[model samples]
Target: MTVTVESRPTGHPGYSQTLPREPESAAIARKLVRTALAAWYLEDLVEDAETVITELVSNAVDHARLESIRVVVTRPTEKLVRFGVVDRSRNVPYMRTDSNGDNTRGRGLLLVDALTDRWGTDRYRWGKQVWGEMKCD
Candidate 1:
């Protein structure tokens, strides 16, 4: 895994890591999120951010065709932080409306929706990025 810190126009540094698209990569992504939040003194958002990243990474690992995916952590503002997973697959993620009480799968996005202030997907020519944002204050 290679981690890189880049300066964003918002004056906050964004951290990203490219990791193999495997279930184990979710742990690494969570650690990256924790480290970045610690450095920014946004520790309060750590738990939700970690959960959001894990779900995003898990979805990518299961559905994306690429061998690798990118995990991104960015502070869009002093009071908000965003977590994103970028994959080569253009398929967008959505919450399954057909999920029932006994179903174990397809609930990740529901958890993400409940935890995040807002979440959405950004489509690009190459792929799509699924992201969730939480408020710090």
Candidate 2:
């Protein structure tokens, strides 16, 4: 996958990449997030951003019905960055409240909620985007 960092004349800079909807793609998505944060000089948010993107990408890989998924990292403001995953699935993700410590899965969104300042989903005509935002100093 060829990842590109984009700069807009009127808006914040962003980075985007399309990857196969597989578990391995989570690593690539983490790299993309790291690169974007580094370019924006928001290295302090790298760990949390990577975790959020990993969960988003993992959910898409497990539930989205497509061969590929798009990972987007955008700086919406000087002190805020958004991480999103776009996939061809209309089903919105919800945190699982029924999982115990013994469960090996279903804790992704819980972690996202704990780490991110805010998180939600955007529904489009073709698909949906799951996103989370973090604030930087």
lDDT of 1 by residue, 46-103 (tens): 8888889999999999988889999999888867788999999998898877758897
State in Å the error of residue 51, model 2.
0.9
lDDT of 1 at 55: 94
The lDDT per prediction is 0.88, 0.88
CA RMSD per model (angstroms): 7.2, 6.9
Please give the distance, in angstroms, between residue 126's alpha carbon in candidate 2 and its true position after superposition. Answer: 1.0
TM-score per candidate, in order?
0.88, 0.89
Q: Tell me the deviation in Å of residue 91 in model 2.
A: 0.4
lDDT assessment of candidate 1: 0.88
For model 2, which pairs clash?
none
- For model 2, what is the error of residue 57's alpha carbon versus the real structure, in angstroms, after optimal superposition? 0.6
Clashes of each: 0, 0
